[model samples]
Target: MNFATRPNFEAISSAPVMQRARGTARIGTKQRDGKTCIDTLFQEGCGKIRLPRTHSSALEAVFINTAGGITGGDHLRWGADIAPEGRLVITTQACERSYRSTGDTAHVEADINVGADAHLDWLPQETILFEASKLDRRLTIRLDEGATLTAIEAVLLGRDAMGEEARDAQFSDTWRIFRGDRLIHAEATRLTGDGSERDGLSLLRGCRAFASILHVAPSADRAEQLLDRVRALHPAAGLIAASANGERLVIRAMARTGLALRKLLVPTLIELTGAGSLPRLWHL
Candidate 1:
């Protein structure tokens, strides 16, 4: 279909998440006969859901999910597709809190596709780990040459509001970034079912909150400029940040508490994106 002749869904103001929610985005190129596609779904099972989409560029869509809390057997699955020259940005309304596991572990999966000359940003808010809760998360990204993607995944051990700490919780996360059919980056972190301690400097450094920011830019020099600022603002405890080879930067910030980390990361995100603030739903 012609760019101007494709069906456009009405701009949804609110995303309802009962037990199941699913979304999709597709785009067609103006030339070269390229195609792009992205789809995401959330299954409540035993939790509340909140997914919202706002604003669109020539070939872009923004998504945010707020899954209040989950017990056991609750799951969320999100996927995306980007055609040649297409772009997308995805976010979450708030932290995903997994309470103490009452049954099985809550699961999350993210699948993405990037067409030639396309771009995508998968920026979800932090995930909070509650005592005794178990979670399994996986992320996979596929991109073609001239395609770009930036993603951020943050995790907070527990809620500080109730004097909760992540010391007693179990969590696991996995991430993979691909350029066309080649894997560019692979990372995994797991803490559970073992007698291993999650404290000390080797891991969280006794901090309850931690965040990771990832950026893939066209220019390595530009990415460095942004990474420099984050390093300057990082705290004294080694800052926990790093930037390596062409066009990729990762920042890790740890704080004594969740709120403290929030104060630091929020401004950093705004600076990196060159925006005053993220979408309103991001702060909710």
Candidate 2:
């Protein structure tokens, strides 16, 4: 064949398309015969919710991501609702992993509602960001004035044992909480590029692991009492701090490694959540 007439194979070749994951999981609880029971549950795609038998009065739920890890173009959503006088505790089966992204950004959203006199504990495990990973996550909670909520979100830049560091990664996290149409707490965090090298007074200060805890009670006095108890724990002197404003209590902690961060979180969470201990999945 003539060179000019021959087909250009290289020019016709195109990059293979990548598959993206999407999932949604929702659970709702109600008070039945003086016990919290599942009222509604929905799960699709890779998102899953498993109910593990617990001796406590509260209903327990564990979320799972069958996709293993999140990457570019992946989307996940979670939601929960608690009926009056019901109690619920939600946790993850394992730490969430955000792998490197080539294009776009991974997205995750969680919405929760608590009825009057209800209680909810949102305690997901740490989210590890791999090098070059990009993620956007948001959490929204709406509860009645008489309800209570205790939530914790933690993050790790990379695996300490593996000596991995998340360089050139991007992470954006936001939280909005409301009590009966009144906004009580709001937080937004954005980190781009190298997080480990950040040293600004308001930044991570060279820490690779960090966590935020929020507790909302029915009254200011209850929140103050919880804050006092947390203070009694003497959380990692310089690495942790707790404060209370009205009916909301906030705690922030940071450390050099995930293990260190957990050391500070475990006891503090136990006190704030009134759970006596963490979920079984947390130990695993």
Candidate 3:
């Protein structure tokens, strides 16, 4: 074979092939023995779910990502459906970490449905982004007119104790909530830059950690009661604010570190969920 016409087998063999993690986890609940129980579960690839023993009447699920952390090109999805009159609580096994990426951004999606008179509490752990990381996440929830839902999403730029900083990072988060075909709440957040923009008064304002909490109920009275209880707690740390809109209550908080953010989040979450305590995984 002529040298010019021959394929470069050496270069082809030397080039590295990228492997990305992709997985989906789905769970559904039903009423059993007068208590909510797992009805169906499906997990594939790097996604995993566990049902730890708990004393609460609601069924609890813990999500796990076997890939360890997310980077460019990784995709993960989670879904949950609660049957009529059922109760469910969902949480992650640990905080999700987003590492540096070369090109594409990592993506995560959550879709949840609440049936008539059902309730769902989504309390995933915080997500930490390292320098140069890019992440895109979205959460969509549909509820029946009689259903209730409480959800929390928190993010940290980097760990304060580790002296890490995500000065160069890109993150986008979107949340949409609907009840009986009507959109009740919608929020979108985007952050991109060398982190200096966070100093703006309307932005994070020098805080390295932030979170959003949402609670929805059939009656405005219930939403108001939870809002009042959260205000009474008066988290000793972090800057926290709560507001009510019709049948929905929303809380926003910012802090210098993850610990301080949690101090503000825990009580508010407890009040919104009305569970008296969070999922056991939160303590671990």
Query: Per-residue lDDT tens digits of candidate 3, residues 1-284?
Result: 65668789999999877899998999999898878999999999999999998898899999999999899899999999999998899999899999999888999999999999998899999999998899999999999969989999999988788977687879999999999799999999898965566788878888889999998977898778877888888755549999988899999999889988898889888877845689988974
Task: Itemize residue pairs with steric clashes in candidate 3.
Answer: none
- TM-score for candidate 3, please give it: 0.95
What is the C-alpha local distance difference test score of candidate 3? 0.89
Model 1, 166-282: lDDT tens digits are 575777789898876777778888877343445655766577778777766667787788778867776665446667567777777778777777777776676655223465656
Please give me the total number of clashing residue pairs in predicted model 2: 0
Q: What's the TM-score of every candidate structure?
A: 0.74, 0.93, 0.95
The stretch of ten residues in a row with the least summed lDDT in candidate 1 is 20-29
Q: Rank the candidates by TM-score, best first.
A: 3, 2, 1
Q: State the C-alpha lDDT per candidate.
A: 0.65, 0.90, 0.89
Model 2: weakest 10-residue lDDT segment is 194-203
Off by over 4 Å in 3: 1-4
Model 1 ranges off by over 4 Å: 1-67, 193-196, 233-240, 274-277
Pitting candidate 1 against candidate 3, the one with the higher lDDT is 3
